[model samples]
Target: MKELIEVLVERKQKNASPLPYHGWVGPCTQVSLLYDGFRLGDASNYDSVKSFAQLMWPDGHPRFCKSMHTMATQIEELNKLIWLMIIDSYGLGEKWESVMINYKMLVQFMKYMAPPPGVYERGLFAHTDKPVSTIICDDQVLGLEVEVKDGQWIKLSLSPSSFCFVVGDPLRAWSNGRLKAVNHRIMMSGDNGRYSIAAFVIPIEGTIIKAPKELIDEQHPQLYKDFDFMEFFLFAFSDPAKHIDSGEQLHAFASLSPPISN
Candidate 1:
């Protein structure tokens, strides 16, 4: 982990050019480089690798690409373990196994430039991830914050060896809203830049997200209707104004018809 962080930080210093693919999204102080496992073995991966190699490392440093690929594979394995835990805890192994096949993973490397002295900036705005789950390996710079149930934002102090696991909209909906999708953001402060890597586990395109029958009872009625995971993802990103920090976008996209009786 430390080696990967060092490599990314060194690359960032040596290359100030815009990122390939989704170049410089969100705040100007933040930039992201993404590697999607789903694109592997396809024409898209070939083109993406060519573009990334040319734009980021003109000299074609194979070590940088190797490091990223290695990290993505590690994170993919970790996500599988976490997913098994979730399935066992919720007893949705059978139902989930059928629909959740061919799950895709995305690894994102984020760099947040330090804000001006004594000023705090929103490097990435507050929002909930649209995937099933996300695992974040944050550096020691300490700018990640999460909103608690009481509406208080708590800054996380994580060590270099630590990893933060966060629930996302699809998982929350799959468990019949029993699992809460956390609202989180990167608050940039101080003079030191922040670096982090996030691995997101997403369902395959057109996977119908629905709660298993075992999780629904009189006490916990069906909260979300069956909806396409990719469709909801597109809906959430299509409109910036509709982006609510509390995961209301999921409700808006997949709430049950006529509402559930209280």
Candidate 2:
């Protein structure tokens, strides 16, 4: 994360503009500059597939906060934890993700009444940060605009960077019969202001990633297997929605279902 901040800092020092908000449905092939600790897309498993965050705008990555980026030598603390993630990812074979969503959105919103930034892609999904926490907002909905998959759409009266985490379904599947992926998202605030930063952490592969053994009883044994990161990445990228369902299609690594022989 420190490295990410540094990259941002360097750019911001030159009076760079904040990176545009890349909506959830981003170009699957595009890459961004604001990189948290986790690798982006999983195209392959044997070798860690290098993927980057989708570019927010043409010149910048995301909302760049000059004040935050200019803070004390904060890079040291960030480097340490990243080391662990690197170790687990490379040495331990633990499939995982870790990220920090800055609060630039809410900050800028308070200044102007223009259209707000779109939700981050995969930003508000089905995964929760460990250590258990919640994000509350003061951006009350003064007026209703539209309806989405599960909730209402309204402008939030908040700052620019009110970042949060949403536990995704993919992690749940990877956890075997252990961890439960949580469904989540962000709502537009209208009356008040919100300020927050969300950091998401996940594990690496080669290890049989699964839910806590306690979650599974005798009635429900382990449902997932120790999968290759590349194998799983391929399945996920091709069809994120389909990868979550249970059946032969869900676990078809190397064409193992009907046509391909194991």
Candidate 3:
């Protein structure tokens, strides 16, 4: 918490683009107190798409033991390392393991607005191509959109210190369609636009992650099949531009991709 807060303060001082955020696994899910978020998913085709920054990873279950909470709260790296294990390592996490993750919700939001998965999967981007979503915000700000084509891009607004997650297509591949990576983009907002930072936890290389015994008790045996995190990360991060708007994809890539600025 100390290190995370320090970084946030520094970004504010710099008036950094989109501002910066520090992410880790904690007792409660992080959310914004002010800004609203969006999700977009439209893969059927349409060269590109976008949305707000978000990410997700299962914490398994919240800690009831005070001692465990104390340890996690004190050690920031533990929070980061655990997440790395999941994404980069492909989830070596067993019971009591917390995962660090990040992603932009814009893609999921766009997917929500666009036709369903089946619609786009059928040769869509080739026909009636679209530049981006029609967007409007409470206040226009810089750093809202990461980059632009033609004239502009789609940007999103979110409050400081708050974070969310998006499901990625790579996950869908790894999850065998159980989870889907979102396709989204920015709409070029002016205010509430900011930079973000996340420290995703990961395990060592060559560890093939699978569902733990706890999440899948006798009644529920292995809902999701197992796979290698390293391979999944490669598939997910290979073309970030393909899914930059998705917090889900970003969260999935946390274990694989390096920090954007530092």
Give the per-residue lDDT of model 3 (tens digit) for 182-210.
Answer: 34332322222322322222324564544
**lDDT for 214 (candidate 2):** 37
TM-score for each predicted model, relative to the true structure: 0.78, 0.33, 0.30
> 237, model 3: CA deviation in Å?
5.2
lDDT of 2 by residue, 183-246 (tens): 3333332333222232222234343333444334456555655454335444544555345532
Predicted structure with the largest TM-score when compared to the true one: 1
The regions of model 2 sitting more than 4 angstroms off are 1-171, 174-179, 189-196, 205-217, 239-262
Model 1, residue 47: C-alpha shift (Å) = 9.4
Point to the candidate with the largest lDDT: 1
Candidate 2 shows a clash count of 46
Badly placed stretches (over 4 Å) of model 1 are 1-26, 29-51, 93-96, 99-101, 240-246, 257-262
Clashing pairs in 1: none
Candidate 3, poorest ten consecutive residues by summed lDDT: 123-132
Give the per-residue Cα lDDT of candidate 1 at 94.
66
